[model samples]
Target: MINPVHLRTLVEVVRLGSFAAAATRLGYTASAVSQQMSALERDTGVALFQRSARSVLPTEAAVVMTRHAAKVLTDIDTLMAAAARTHESTSQELRLGIFPSLATYVLPRILQNPAWRKLGIELRVSVAEPGQTIQGLRTGGELDVALVYQVGQSGLAWPHTVNRQWIGDDDFRVVLPAAWGIGPESKVAADHLSDMPWIMHHPGTSDATVIERLFASCNLHPRVVAYSDDFHASLEMAAAGLGAALVPELALLHRPPGVVVLDVPEIRLARNVFALLPKEQLTAQVQLFVELLADTLHKLGTTRRD
Candidate 1:
């Protein structure tokens, strides 16, 4: 293949009309420049110069090659500039993994905030559960940040190298069918709920274990009428009078009309929300995003539903 370096040297030599002068401009010895021109001629199988004892003159072939070489070099420069711009745009993008409830309720608020515009980050979001999001933070994973929550002793683990920051808390609210005569202002005792039909998390899962233990502590063994992992589905089930359900405040943002959220002091538990990042990926933009997300969550948590 013809070398681009050789083409560059040929262009210089033709333009300068002297091997010694081309060498001076290119930071090479005159003999080195002559040797390169010879190699280029061999590669192209065309004579590029007329050599005499005093002068090194460009042939017709040399002049034509130099003209084409200028265009080739310019194209290479343009390609390099385009590649650099692509790299800059990729660097400014943030790959985020978040759970469904937060994505549905909290994320929209953050996006609406005026502060989010100033962060100047292009978000590529993946909506999944906490376990899935944590998996996306492992080595060779696509996510740069994960927003997850932890229920009491409901063990969720990530790589030790991952960095964590406390964002906010999502307190669980006990929701009952309004037809059951439970009012929103009701302060239901845990023991009174012992015989109530309940929609619980699927058995043996991290969340279910914690909730069952909490119920047992209160000496209230709920009769499980249905099992669901999705808080939205659970809320709908409760609204349909299938059973009472414990749902996070985030999920209560759009509570169905037939459900009444109660304040159960005996079941005072909350899922702690956190932001997870790769140790090396904790940039200022990512931190700002987390801060905005936390602020949004706090506002949502305090917003009352009629």
Candidate 2:
């Protein structure tokens, strides 16, 4: 392959019409410039210069090659500039997906994080559930990063091409209507809910599936009063004295007015929140955002406990 450096030297030598002048302009010795031109000629199998003892002259071949080299160099410069711009664009832009509940409770804190502004990442978000977010990662190239959660080993379908980093766990707490007289900090047993009216996620969702299994494992069958996929909506139903619903710790960040959070040890359904990205597209900004998210989750957990 012809070296671009030698092509450049040859072009300069042809343009300047003297090896010595080209060497002076290029900050190389005349001998070095002549060696480069010789190497280039050898590589091309064409004599690029007509040489005499007193002065060197560019041959027709040399002149033609110089014109082509000038254009080639310009093209290379343009390609490099375009590549740099693309890299800059990637660094500045972030396409993020978050579960609906996280968007409500955690997204504000993420936006408020100083690191978010310091990184200058422009975010575009998709508010979706965990399953939908995972599907988006597989089908759509639009998302650079997705914040998704899995309820235990809920058998959620995730693309193999995605890489996951565990951000944190969202512990599920049973929320009952205030009128039901369940103390906010009281530990409720799984068997205690056998006959209670329950507000749950749509039956087929990862969350609902896990909750259903939890009930089955405890040999308790509760009557489903209402079904809602939205945590906020489920919380509203729970608050209205309709039934109890399993809610994540993050969702409880803005605890509804009429609901009391109960501790259910036997029903241990903690959803693991992860930062999922297409393996090939994980950039520094995305990694930093994941780190910031984990930190934000920790701070939020602490604040809630206090």
Candidate 3:
């Protein structure tokens, strides 16, 4: 069989019109070039060049093969280059595990990075609840990074093999139903909630920490009639007047018709969003994602409040 190298040599010899010139151009001995063309002829069962003492002429078939070989070599070079670039760009996959609370809101905005497409990043986002995310990261299941609300206490005190950064501060303020008559434009305070039933995040979750802080600040025991871990479920329950719960601004991206985000002062009930990544996850792509996520959260903190 004719090697691509040998075929390339045949094409060059045909183009330059001499074995010596093709050899000079290709850094091969003249005799080597002649032997390659002979091998090419033998492989294809057709003589490719007519040899002379001074000039080598192409056989009738050699001219056709030479023309086509030029295009083939060009295509092969292009394919190899593109393949190399693809491999280089996608050398690593970014496995990101996001808390469910964030999967529906802030995470989408981070995906809109102008450079995401260019880098050929394969983003794998796991939308398990917070506990599962931490579990997966700890057990080395598959998370390269995670976005989780900072629980008041760390569960996996395993020296945190990952690097972490606080992304944003989400005020765990109250969410009141539209009919509360708090006025569409008014920011409700904790004191005004004296007559309102309290809606709090599910007991023992990150949001619960903020809720407990709010009650302690008011010096009143909360009448938390209902609680939910699912943000959407908690919001719906709140909309239906189950009770008023504190939800972050990102969760309220598109407000329902009868809801208001009540602002509270020095509300210690705030969840500090954090981006967690394994130390090995600090590749250029993962670093870019972490930066994108942090920037997105900061923007939401400033501009996304309802």
Candidate 4:
């Protein structure tokens, strides 16, 4: 194989028209540069220079080899640059999974945060609810971390390889249409909801299972008028006076018109949001993001105080 160092020396020597000049630029002795050119010539089995007392001039073959060497060096540099970019993309990228409802509020906050900017990380997000997010963590090599929520002790599956940390709580609130004659600040009693029409989640979903049990535990079951997993749809249904719906405080960040958010002191059904990782170990970016996210959620909760 042709030594790239020798070839490079040859190119410089040819461009400068003197071994002494090339050696000066490369910080090598003139004799060393001459030896490198002589080895290069022996490797190629061709005379590379015509030596005379007046000057050492490049032979036709040497000029041609220099041209080819420049092109080869350029291609090698391009290849090395591409390899470096691929390494950076793999090392500095973060893959995150979150729920659909959270994508609407939390995602933008996480992306736009100054802390996120400082991390110099590229984020790739996948929107899936808790159960699906957990499953993805188990089998999906692409998922590095996840933001998920669980309603008090409700069963969730996980392999022993995962780790969980509580980030914050998203408290559920009673949403009533303006026609309900209830002020937004007024506390609604549990007993009053009995025999009242309500909007609920479809059966078998994680949220629906927890919410159904919550109402059952309170000994209050209302007539179900609509079933939807979409918080926005549920909010719209409640605003249309279709029925009352239970929604998380975060879901109300964009509080739609015609619906009043009320406190249900008799019920406490807050979903505990958590950060789930493949293992307990966290990269600097992930750890910083978790801290910033907790701070953001705390500020949001404080601002929405009833």
Superior by TM-score: candidate 1 or candidate 3 = 1
Name the runs in model 1 displaced over 4 angstroms.
1-91
Local error of candidate 3 at residue 215 (angstroms) = 1.0
Candidate 1 on 1-306: residue-level lDDT in tens?
Answer: 454445556667867877777766754446556667777678667676656544443321222334444554566555445544554465468899998888898888778765566455789999998999999888577898999999986889988888989989998989999889978787679999998899999998999999999999998889999999988899999999999999988888888889999888889899999999888887545765776677667666777444
The predicted structure with the larger TM-score, 3 or 4, is 4
lDDT of model 2 at position 135: 73
Task: Write the residue-wise lDDT of candidate 3 on 1-306 in tens digits.
Answer: 234455556657767777767766654446556666666667667655445433343321222334434454566555445645655655677777887667877777656644344344677878976667877788855787777776455343322577887777766646778776675457545566665687666666544665576577785456778766666776787787677766766677765657767666645455667777778776544554565566567667787665
User: Worst ten-residue run, lDDT, model 3?
Assistant: 55-64
**If ranked by lDDT, best first, what sequence of candidates would result?**
1, 4, 2, 3
Alpha-carbon RMSD of each model: 20.7, 18.1, 18.3, 19.4
Better of 2 and 4 by lDDT: 4
TM-score-based ranking: 1, 4, 2, 3
Residue pairs clashing, model 3: 199-244, 210-269
Candidate 4 lDDT by residue in tens digits, 1-306: 344455666668867877777766654446556767777677666676665455444321223334444554566555445544554555567788888767787778767764456444677889988888887778846588888888877787776787787888989988889888999777568877877999988988777888887788887798999888888988998888899998899889887788988887777899899988776447544665676677667767898755
Evaluated against the true structure, the overall lDDT of model 3 is 0.63
TM-score for candidate 3, please give it.
0.65
Scanning candidate 1 in windows of ten residues, the lowest lDDT window is 56-65
TM of each candidate vs. truth: 0.69, 0.67, 0.65, 0.68
Off by over 4 Å in 2: 1-91
